[model samples]
Target: MHVLFLAPEVWPFKRVGGLAEVAYDLPRALAALGHKVGVVTPKPRLSQEMEQGLERLDTVLEVPVSWKRHLAEVYRHQEPSGVEVYLIGHEHLFDREGLYGNAYGDYEDNAERFIFYSRACLELARTMDWRVDVFHANDWTTGLVPVYLRTLYAGDPCLKDAASLMTVHNLGNQGQFWHYDMPLTGLGWEYFVPEALEFYGQINFLKGGLVFADMISTVSHTYAQEILTPELGRGMEGVLMARRDRLAAVVNGIDYQVWNPADDYRLAANYDRHDPSPKARCRQELMGHYGLEDGGGRPLVAVVGRLEDRKGLDLITAGMERFFEVGLNLVVMGYGEDHYHVALGELAARHPGRLGLTIGFDIDLAHRIMAGVDMLLVPSRYEPCGIHQMQALRYGVVPVVRDTGGLADTVVDQRPGVEGTGFKFEPFTMEAMLQTLDRAKQAYDRPQEWRGLMQRAMAQDFSWQAVAPRYEEIYRKALELAGQRQRA
Candidate 1:
């Protein structure tokens, strides 16, 4: 089977969040399973630097946009396992410093930019004459790709039979815009109804994909169920409910080659499941880096990623007093919300060596922190899927995550007789998160139980090896659904 993955950003060249991580890992996993897989994404400004060992295939074609005719170049890279990647380079949409917009806001023309990319993807597949069995679309950026397959190319022999699977990374980012832009997508006002692109009288790209695509997926099984509710759907539960039969849940996986503890160059000492000596060295390095006391008395807990309301960071912020009172050392990283940033800095200043804080994105520090810390904190209000927790688990660091989305699906609660992987909290409140943290702190007292939990988390395989076959099944299901539609 041949599959085309459509996204706004790809890994290494452009990474905004977990979507890029999934885009990077899943296709290669599928290719390893003996499927012909290809990807089309807006070439990032850093693409040239990241294109080492990749060959420029050729100038594909002139792709049309509402603004201008963009010349798209196709580049290919074969992984060690024989998976292929094709990058679509267009200067106008992608020649920017960042994958997402700058600190101010999102790109003003994101809708138009992604619409152009989706159209170019279809054109490339048609010109190459590839019998694309499945077109796997990610997030809201490439949402219109499925719409094009089902509407514009519905009757064309070259495209009519191609199936599609659309994954919604987050429900909030629905690419909502004015209804007038429907014509620009080559679809008419007819699609701007309650059942199609419409969401409360506005146009929604993700909604269109959910309504028109052969099958729909969210990041995790729990998330698949979450989005069908009024509280979590972000105003699209009605449409999702109508198409629940075609909806399924397959959790995301990590690239083990990069995330494996034994081979990771980011750590001070590399250790695997067998030998745990290197982990102590890494922990010491982490403590030294953060100015925390390198001792076994107090466990060091690390919190990473954006400091926003949605991350439920307020829970942590509100519970700082308890941490200091309980003699727990905390390390905080990543950036968001000016007020939260200021408050955290003040907490560190007041607590002296007990608290460590870094205010922005640093890839190297992230890996080191994960490896060094005894526990990771991820208290999200509603996480579709989080990659950092998986990274922490791989490093033998138990994660204390809110029991929602992928966290619920992956983390097994380490209570008495449970034999779980990590600590899980419910209610999405400060008290609940604090209770879970207290449990993690309690587990730190018993070294054998802590080691057993760490070993369990490390032993559990979250790699794409176990997940790709499920995706293959999804593709086959999409093809079957498309065939049924044709017969009907």
Candidate 2:
């Protein structure tokens, strides 16, 4: 199959979230599975590794921006597993130091920027005569791909037979903008309907993809079902329900080659599924590095990813004094709201021994934090499907995740013989999380019981080798749908 992935970011090049990581790793695995997979993403400000990695491919294609056209270069990189990556290189649109923006706010012209990129990718693919079998677009940034292919590019020779699959990593960011902006970016006003792009009287880029794409998928099966609800649904329930048969819930996978604790380059000491003692050594190293005590007594709970309200970072902040009261230490690596940043800063200052907070992601430190921490926290309000819990589990860091979305699907609560993988709570409330943590705290006191579950979690597999076939089936299903449409 000839697969073309469209996204705003890709790992090792531009990573602001899990979508980039998926974009980077999944194509490699898909290529290994005998598919011709390639990705088209905005060229991030290049690093030495990035510059060395990508070979210049097709160059200087003009893509329409609001009203005028801008030039972009396409560079290709073949991954170790032989997946070709096409980077859309244009400085004016993507030359910024940050992926999205700095601390103040995202670029005001984000809607126009991503929409232009989406159209550019399709236009480039058409010009290259790449009749994509599956144009799998990730998140809202590239949501316009399916809409453009199905509508404006409907009968174009290169895109006439192409099918699309849009995976909702998280529904919260629906990319809502002023409905009037549609015309400015060349999107038809017909797309701004309640059933299509419009959500709560605004243009919703994410819903446009969900409506027009041949098929839709969320990160996990649980998330797939969860999105069809009123509470969890971000006003897309009706649209999601309309496409019930077209929706799938395949859990996200981790790049074990990079994340494996046993062979991790970031860890202080390598450890396996059997012996987890190195976890303690790694923990001490992490504590020492963060200027915390190296004492091996307090249970270290580390949380990575965005420290936003949606990620349940609020529960952590609300329950900070309680975490220390429960005799636990905290470490965080993420960036978000000013209030969150200031609050976390204060927590780190007030409670030196119990907390360590870094404002943004540190790749090496993230791996070390995963390997070192006794438990990893992902109390997400709504995680479509998280890859961190899987990575933390593989690293022998028992996850204490809120019972929502993929967390509910992946991390099994501690049982008797089943001694499950990690811990789970309900309601997405601090009280609920604290109650579960209390139980986890009790379990932690029983080192033998805790170790059994942590090992069990590490033993579980969340590999792409297991998930790529699911995506393959979905891709085929999209082709089937396209065939039906053609026959009609």
Candidate 3:
């Protein structure tokens, strides 16, 4: 099979979140299975380091955006895993200080920027010598791909047999804009009705993709079902319900090459479940680095993600004082929301030796935290598929997470047998979280039991090799759907 992946960001080149990581790993995994995979993403302001060696194609694509046309330079590079990467360069639109926007906010012309990129992707496919079997798009940024394929380019021979799959990483961020911006899409007004792009009197890019794509998938099976309801759907329940048969829920996978503790370059001491003496050394080093007492006689719990309301950081803030009373030390690393920054700063100051805080991302530190911490906390309001917990499990760090979405699917609450890997809580409240922490502490007190749980976690596999077949099955299903639609 020949597959083309369209995403706004790809790992090691331009990454802001998990989508980039998936965009990088999934295609490589497929390519390893003998599928010819290609990735297309915007070329951000590249440093000399990011563009070391790449074949630049002389072909300049003239992409139309509404009434105007923009030129883009295409460059090709091959990954070590044999996947080809195509970068679209439009300095005026993509070569920015950040991927989407800077610290202030998202770029005001985001709708237009992505619309242009989507059209370019289609044009690139239309002109390429090889035929594409699947055009897999990710998130709201590439939402217009399916729309263009089914609408304006419906009759184009090149794309008539190609299928599209749109994977929604987060339904919360539906690309919604004023109805006036519909012209920017270079698509007809007929697409702006409620059944298509329109969402509560506005133009919704994600809705357009979901409506037109041969198939739709969320990051996790639990999240796929969650989004079909009003509370979690973010106002797309009706449209999604209409395409229920076309929806899929494949859990995301992690690249073991980068995350494996036995050979990780980032960890202070590399160790796996078989040899965990290095993990204790890492814990001691981390405690000293944070200025906390190395021998506190308490479990060290860590939080590593954006400190936003959606992450349920507020729940931690609400229960911090009580958590300390239960004899546990805390370490946090992330940056988000001015209020959270200020609140976390004050809390860290008050607790001094008991709490440690790092305001920004440190990749090395994140790996060390996963290797060192006794427990990892992720009390998200709703998580599509969290990579942190998966990485934590890989490092033998027990995760105490809210039982929702992927967390619910992956983490098995501590049970009597050897099957248990982590702890979970319900209702998503401070009280429930604190009680869950108490349970973790109880298990922690029993060193024999905790070690068994850690062993179980490290033994569990969340690698892409385990998940690539599921995606392959979905791709075949999508092709069948597209063939039917084409015949109709």
* Number of the candidate with higher lDDT, 1 or 3: 3
Q: Rank the candidates by lDDT, best first.
A: 3, 2, 1
For candidate 3, write residues 1-488 as lDDT tens digits: 99999999887788777788899999999998999999999888888867777678988988999999999999888899999999999999998988777879989899999998899999888768658899999888899899988888888888878999999999998888999999999988888898889988999989989999999999888998999999999998888999999999989989898899899887778888887768887888888889886445799999998899999999999899998998899999998788899999999999888889999888889888888899999999999998899999999999999988999889999966546899999788999899899999999899898888888899989999999999999899999999998788
Q: Which candidate is the best by TM-score?
A: 3
- Please report, in order, the local distance difference test score of every candidate based on alpha carbons: 0.85, 0.86, 0.89
Error of 1 at 59 (Å): 2.4
Cα RMSDs of all predictions? 2.0, 1.8, 1.4
TM-scores for the candidates:
0.95, 0.96, 0.97
- Give residue 2's lDDT in candidate 2 (0 to 100): 96
Question: Per-residue alpha-carbon lDDT of model 2 for 1-488, expressed as tens digits?
Answer: 99998888888788888988899888888998999988998888887876987788745787876677877888888777777778888788788977667767778778877887898889778778887899999888888888888788888988889999999998888887887687756766776778778888888889889999999998988888888999888788989999999999899999989989888887889999889887878987998888876455778888899889888978889899999887788899998778999999998999887798899888988898998888888898888888889999998888899888899999999856666899888887888888878788788889898888888988898998898999999999999998898789
**Consecutive 10-residue window with the lowest summed lDDT within model 3:** 288-297
For model 3, the superposed segments whose C-alpha errors exceed 4 Å read: 416-418
Across 1-488, the per-residue lDDT of candidate 1 in tens digits comes to: 99998888777667766777788888889988998888878777763457675688755767766546667887776767666677777788778876657767878777777888888898888878878899999888888888889888788777889999988999978888777776668777788888788888788888888888999987899999999999999888888899999898888899889888798898899998777658989988988888886444688898998899888889899999997666678999988788899999999998878898999878889888988888999999999888888888898999999999998988999888899989998898878888888888889889989988889889988899999999989899999999998899
TM-score of 3: 0.97
User: What is the clash tally of candidate 3?
Assistant: 0
Pairs with backbone N, CA or C atoms under 3 Å apart (clashes), candidate 2: none
